[model samples]
Target: MRLRRSARIRGPGGSFLRRPPLRVNVASPIELRPSPDGRFLACGDQVGWLRERGYGVDSDGCRALELYEALYLVERGDAAALGADGAPLDVSGLISLGSKRNPRFLTKYIVYRDLRNRGYVVREGYGLGNDLRVYRRGEYGSRDARYLVVALEEGRRMSASTLGRIYLRALNLGKELVLAVVESHGDVIYYSVSQFNLRRRLDDAA
Candidate 1:
C-alpha cells in the first residue's frame, strides 16, 4: 500500500517538499534527529533539569519527562517499570537519569522497533555499502521482497527507476527485480507493509 497522506514535516533535516495545503499536527524539529550518529540534540521539555534549580520547585517537567520515558520503555520491549529514562516510578528515593537529552534516541529507537515488528531484518547504521538497509525474510537471492534505499537529496532530481536500481545493487539483489524507493526526506519517515511481493515483480520481469 502507498503512504495514504504525507505528513507535514519540515526543518533543518528536511529538503524542500511541496507544503501541504492544510496544516497538520506534526512534531517540531526538536522531536526528530538528523541522523542516528548525531546523538547530542536534546528534546526533553526541561523537567529533568529542575533538580539543578535547587530544592522546592514542583518539578512538573519531571513528571512529563517521566511519562515520555515510560512510553519509551514500553516501546523498547522492556517492562513498564524498568525505568528507561527516570528513576523507578514506583520508588520515591532515587532518581537515575540519562546524561544526554537528545530526543533522537527515542526516534531511532521507535523506527527500529516498528520496522522490526513489521517483519523486516533491519540494519541500523549503514549496511553493505548502503546508507540504510532493510530486507524481508526468505532467501537472499531472487529478490523476493521490496527494499528501501534511503538518501538525502542533492541538487538534481533523480527518477524512481534509478533509485530502485541503486537499492537492488546495494543490497546485492543483482538486477531490476526488486521494489525500491529513494526516500529523500529524513523526517518524513516511511514504513513498508509486506503484503507486496517482490517475487511477483521478478517473475513479471522474467
Candidate 2:
C-alpha cells in the first residue's frame, strides 16, 4: 500500500512539521521602461511595491518581465536611442516624445495635478520648445517652470560608463534617479540613485 502525503509531513524522528514543496504563482505582466542604453530597470511589480513570499521566484523573473516591457516600449515610438551624458548631444531641432507613451507618465502628471490642487498656479510650457515644462503661479524662482527632459528612453543602446556618468550628473543636479527592471514576467525590481548621492558626497569630501 502506498501512503499519500498530506499538506503536512512527518519527519524520520517522528516529528510533525509542515514541509511542503515550493510552488510557482501566476502573475500578470506589468509595464516598465529601459534606459536608452538598452539596459533593463525595475519598476516594481504589477501588483505593488512589495515582494511576494513563498512564490518560488526571484529577481530573474523581474528581469525577464523588464525585457518584455522593453519589447513593448520599443514598439511604441515613445522610446528612442540617444547619446550618452555630455557627449556633445545636439537635441536642438530634434523632436522628442514628450511623455507620450511612458508607462509612468501618469505618475508625473499626477504630481502636476497635486501641485495644482495645492493652489499653485501651473501652466503648460516646454523647454526651449523641447519637452513639456511646469511653472508655478507666478514669480520666477528656482522652482519656476523648468524643462522636463527624458534623458534616457527605453530600448536605447548606450555604454555602461556613459550611463553611469548620466546618473552621476542627475545626482549632481539634486535629482534622484529612479529605475525599474522587471524579470521574466515574474516580479519587478526597483532602485534609486542613493549610491550616486553617496558617491557624490564622498567626492565632495575628497
Candidate 3:
C-alpha cells in the first residue's frame, strides 16, 4: 500500500486529524466444507487465519481441515462445518459422525483439543491414527515442528516395536517425540520420549 503524502484538508487554516481507526476485536464465524474425496474439509478465504495458525494443509487454493481440527473450531465458536445439504452441523452432531468415521476419533480429538487449548499449534502427523505434529507456543508457521505426538489411551497396550518405529520417525524428522495419553476420565497427560544409547552409557560406566 502506498502512503498518502498528506491525508488532510486546509479547513479553517488547519484540518483536524481523521478519526482513529477502530481497533476492536470482532469475531466472525468461519465456513468450511468437506472435500470432494470426503477425507478432508475444504475452506476458502475464511481459513486464512486457521492456515496461518497451522490448522490445516494446503489443497489447491484452499486449506483442508481434518475432523479433529474441525471439531475444535466448532467447539471454539470460530467455525462451522457445512454439510452437502448446505446446513451447518452442530458440535454434538459432528462428534457423532466423527466417531463413526474414525474409531479413535474422540481420543484424537481430546488430545488435539487439549494441545490447542494449552497454546500449541498442531498439524497432521506422519502416521495415521498414531500421532500429531505440534509446534511450540509462538513458533508455529515460522519454525519447524517441534514435537511428534503419539496419542494413546490409558491402559491400552502398544507393542514396543511400534513405539520404536515412531521414535525413529521423530528422530529422522529432527523433532522431539511426545506421547499423549488420554485417561478414561477424560484427561490428557503428555510425556516426552527420546532415544537412549545404552551401549554408549555402558561403555562410559565401564
Candidate 4:
C-alpha cells in the first residue's frame, strides 16, 4: 500500500516533525501498560479510549491490546505505548521489539495494516487459530465479527490438517475465513475459504 505523505507538526524547537501516514482522531493519546505475562499490552484506564476507537475488550472487561494493535496505534501517532521497561517507543523501535518477539511480525503487520487501511475493525484472535477477528466497517459492537483472518507469508505453506481445523472453527463460529498472504514487497493478497462436500452418483449407463 502507498503511504500518504507525512504531515508536518511543529516541534518544541519550532521545527517541523514528520508524522506517520495514518491518522486517528482522539481526544488524548492512549496509554499502554505492559502486561504481567509479558505478551500483551493492557490499557488500564485507557481501556475506554481504545475501545471507542474500535479496540475490543476482553472478558476481563479491560482492553488488552495485542502486539499488532499497539504497533499500529503507535505508528499512527494515536497512542504513546511504553515498553516493559516503561520507555516510549517510536515506530522503528516498536518494530524492532516486535520482530524480536515474533519472527512473523513483519508479515502480520503488513496484513494488519492493510486491513485497517481498508476500514475494517481488527482485533487479535485469542485462541481462535487466526491472527485477527475482523468486523465489517461500521458493524463493530453491533454484530459479531464477520471474518477471521490468518496472516501468512506469501510462500509459507500450511498443512491440510491445520487448514481443516481453522476452517472448521470458522464454520462453527459462523464467520468467514480469510487468508492474508503478505509478500516480501509489502503487498497483501486475501483469499476467502469455506468448506464443502460432494459425492458422485453412479451412472446407470456406465
Best by lDDT: 3
- For all candidates, what are the clash counts? 3, 20, 0, 0
Clashing pairs in 3: none
TM-score, candidate number 4:
0.76
- Give lDDT for model 3: 0.69
Runs of candidate 3 with Cα error greater than 4 angstroms are 1-26, 39-44, 197-206
Residue-wise lDDT of candidate 4 within 103-197, one digit each (tens)? 87766776777788677888877474437888888998899898889889768977666677787788888888888876654456777775642
State the TM-score for model 2: 0.23
lDDT of 3 by residue, 1-206 (tens): 11112222111122212432231221776777877665456565555776777877788877788877877777666776887687788667677778787778777777777777666888889863568988888988689988888888889986566666677778889988887887765666777775664334335555
Better of 1 and 3 by TM-score: 3
For model 2, how does the per-residue alpha-carbon lDDT over 16-97 read when each residue is reduced to its tens digit?
Answer: 2233222223243333333454333334453232122111113544432222222222222222223234232111201123
Worst 10 residues of 4 by lDDT: 197-206
Candidate order (TM-score): 3, 4, 1, 2
lDDT of 4: 0.68
Is candidate 3 or 4 superior in lDDT?
3
Query: lDDT order of candidates, best first?
Result: 3, 4, 1, 2
